[model samples]
Target chain A: MSILAVGTVAFDSIETPFGTAPRVLGGSASYLTLAARYFCPDVRLVGVVGRDFPDDYVQRFRDSGIDLRGLETDESGDTFHWKGRYHYDLNERDTLDTQLNVLVDFEPTLPEDYRSSQIVCLGNLDPAVQRHVLDQVDDPEYVLCDTMNYWIEHTPDSLRETLQRVDCLVINDSEARELANEPNLVQAADIIRDMGPETLIIKKGEHGALLFNGDTVFSAPAYPLEAIEDPTGAGDTFAGGLAGHLAQVGRYGADDLRRGIIYGSAMASFVVERFGPERLYHLNRELIVERARAFRELAAIPKLAPLQAA
Target chain B: MSILAVGTVAFDSIETPFGTAPRVLGGSASYLTLAARYFCPDVRLVGVVGRDFPDDYVQRFRDSGIDLRGLETDESGDTFHWKGRYHYDLNERDTLDTQLNVLVDFEPTLPEDYRSSQIVCLGNLDPAVQRHVLDQVDDPEYVLCDTMNYWIEHTPDSLRETLQRVDCLVINDSEARELANEPNLVQAADIIRDMGPETLIIKKGEHGALLFNGDTVFSAPAYPLEAIEDPTGAGDTFAGGLAGHLAQVGRYGADDLRRGIIYGSAMASFVVERFGPERLYHLNRELIVERARAFRELAAIPKLAPLQAA
Candidate 1:
């Protein structure tokens, strides 16, 4: 099975209460492709970077087994750069700057082979671009799309058009409320499902995520971490792991989706341990399994016997 | 086995986005005793109410199999009254008024029979009063105490003195942070555990709860409900259900604590479905079991197979 990811691949300067990272390798596709490669080797990344992109960073992606055939190089302009600062509570952050140099006139072009990708992941990007990518790919087995409040509020019509083609929508809790204009998550899920995606996952930073599929709802717990140096790219990494697991399993049964959520959660937990993609650089399958096992234990409860009347 | 609950027994005027309940029977002990009665038949309630308390409400406790021997009636003043207004989100509320008539000078005295109770649940109250009740009771099998931010800030010395005597402490997330003066929950749990109880449960309103015991941590998901009429007494109800379950099971094993958390979560979920204690009036054991099963299913994830190397 093959998975395709489309989003920014650029540089980020992040400042958190713990510390700061200057122009580290970041962007949605960077994190997504790296995390997806953990579960599915045949990952195709389609995004643009400027001449400012480092050679070693490019080599790192290649070494991670991500296919870069669809990646575009814009030598005339600088790479997209974003600067952000997080408060003491990492739950919220303020974007200091966003320079969309190469991304301003970006037009994603899928590789010939990527058209047959079984799973497509659209990271936080322009809804118009997300829909354009969907038009290029043939009917994917599963399309997982991620969006932020910016797109939902600015370009809702385009976002809705893109969402209609996605099988799953992954957004944080507040975004879900803003998108549906419903504060209640259950109601938001219903409204979003009616608009398009059959599967809706509402991510609640440290509280974990909720998976709503038709009549079934599953609550996934976030892995408890003692140290979270940086929370950059946690959501995109989550989406990547989820799409990657689904691609590897090649099925969307309830059990499979639950497992995928756990894998995604585990991956996100590791990503937040250090700044940018540093944690994933040294991550292994064994550590992922161990963390997933811990999650199972954290949520495990003894089977209840039938209630006996007193 | 017998479980003793000590707290307020008073009237509450609650207003939520959905509806309003004026001057309904509401208080920590009122809800705690009601919820605990589902699991433990011999629930001893120790609290003070004014002579204005209705005869039928007293009969209601008697009908629910909750011992009222330790409940005191003060003829000089009115019952403690609380008026609160919940925001649309239902997670935060504003205390519009607090008329602590009988509770202001309240002194809890456990009945002679209650001294031998196997489990003691100290609901949210003055820490000195909690310690007084603990002083009267013999060494019980398990002692669970709940507290709020007011006491943690105003009476730190007495609260610490009470904490050292309890086996377990349960409080909401914000209060945990405030009490421990640690923003991060993991760190806060460690700080609190070192100060007193070996086990700590931090409740996160609609987000569910986390149980920290020794080196173990268990995450319990809150039951997803479409509508929540009133969130008053949810925390106390959770404490009641947890203490009651532990007493009925008569064990403090890891498995038992996890089950107790789930039971507490379920009871709290039902409590919010209607204003005050109205929902619990008609709730049966079968419904509680069914809701608990739903929570288990919501959190159940299939065991992950070993991740295959990509």
Candidate 2:
């Protein structure tokens, strides 16, 4: 099965309490493509970038079996750029700058070959653009969408409309509560489920992620890391791993979804270990699996006697 | 096997985003006794109260098989009282008032019969009180102590001295970081293990708890609840269940510690579902076992084929 990932493919400068790096090739598509390439070799990448973005970085995707036919080159403008710094508590960060060069006016167009992909990943983007990508897909099996607080605050109706077309929704804990207007996360998942998607995964960063499917719910903690070099692209990498693993399995069950989360978490662990996509870009299958095992072990509490009923 | 819980037995008025409860029976010892009473029938309570404290409230402990012989009544002063309000986020609260009546000159004296208890739970209290309680234990097999930032910030040396005497230390994530002076939690656990305790459990409130032993680390997420009436005694209840389970099994190993965390999480689940200790007071073994099962189920992620190691 093939996967289609649509989002920004640009540059980022990020700093944390640990350290800082400047002007790195980092964006949703860049991180997603590298992570998803580990599970599925044939991943279709669709995003606009400026001419100045390194050819070596673009060539790296091609080398990793990611089809770059949908990668648009805007010769007139520099690539989209973002700079941010994390606080002592890595869970939150402050955006230092944002330069939406080519990204300001670019319209996404899926290649004919990518139109038949089975799994679609709509990374954080305007609701209108996300819908347009879905409109081009010819009956994809699973369409997972990731959005931020920006879209939720500005385009509630457009976001809700896009939610109706996706099978999975990946959002952070606060955004979930804000979108559903419910303080309780469980209630928020319920409200979001009612709005559309059959599954909702609430990413709580360091706390981990929660999965909700009807009354059934599952939670897995993130593989706790010691030093978080950079947090940029972690979420998109997570979504990529989830979609990639599910596409490989062809069926998404409780167990499969749980494993998918582990995969997503493992991918994210590497994403934060280095600035931009440095660590994830060089991540091999062996390391990914090792991290996955570490997560399983870290969260592996021994089973005690079962609880008696109320 | 019996458990000894040493801490405060006071009153509190709590207000949350959901509702408010005025002048409820609360305190570390009160919550610990109720929580420990679930696993081991014998829980020796050692604390001080005042003349205004009612009889029925004390009777609740007597009915739960708690030895209240060490509970001193100060006729000259009023009971210690606290008032606090939680924001929409239950994890944080603003302190409204703190009236240390009997607690001002409080001196805990372990009953003659209490010194021989096999399990010791040193609930959050003044470092001096915690140290006094430690002196009373007669070669206890398991001594677990809980502390907050109050002591960590004020009496660093006394806290360190008390920490060295305990086998397991239970503290919040921030306190753990603060105590070790390490920014990274993983590294903080390492420094803490070097300080004294054989194992460390970092409580992250709703995020969950992390247990770090010599080379093994286990994590358990807080069971997702629909409503959190009051978080006043959740941590004490958690410690109670942990020490209580250890006393019941008469064993404390890496595996047992892992199971202990799960049991603790289960007991805490009951604490927040109602006001003060009302929910936990009526808890039975069957009910606890059911919640323990739910914790196991909630943490169950489908096992994946081991990732290929690099």
Residue lDDT tens for model 1, B201-260: 999988999999968899999888888889899999999888878877889988889999
Q: After superposition, how far is residue B48 of candidate 2 from its true place, in Å?
A: 0.4
Each candidate: what lDDT?
0.90, 0.86
Write candidate 2's Cα lDDT for A35-70 as tens digits.
888888788898999978888988788877888999
Mark the 10 consecutive residues where model 1 chain B has the least summed lDDT.
B105-114
Q: State TM-scores per candidate.
A: 0.98, 0.97
Pairs of residues clashing in candidate 1: none
User: For model 2 chain A, where is the 10-residue window of minimal lDDT?
Assistant: A301-310
Instruction: DockQ each candidate and list the results.
Output: 0.76, 0.55
- Tens-place lDDT per residue, model 1, A1-310, is 9998999998999999899999999999999999999999899999999998989999999989889998999998999999999988688899999999999989887778888888989999999999889889987999999999889889999999999899999999999989999878888899999999999999998999999986889999998788888999999989888987898888988888899999999999999999999888888899988988899998887898665564
Q: Which candidate gets the maximum lDDT versus the true structure?
A: 1
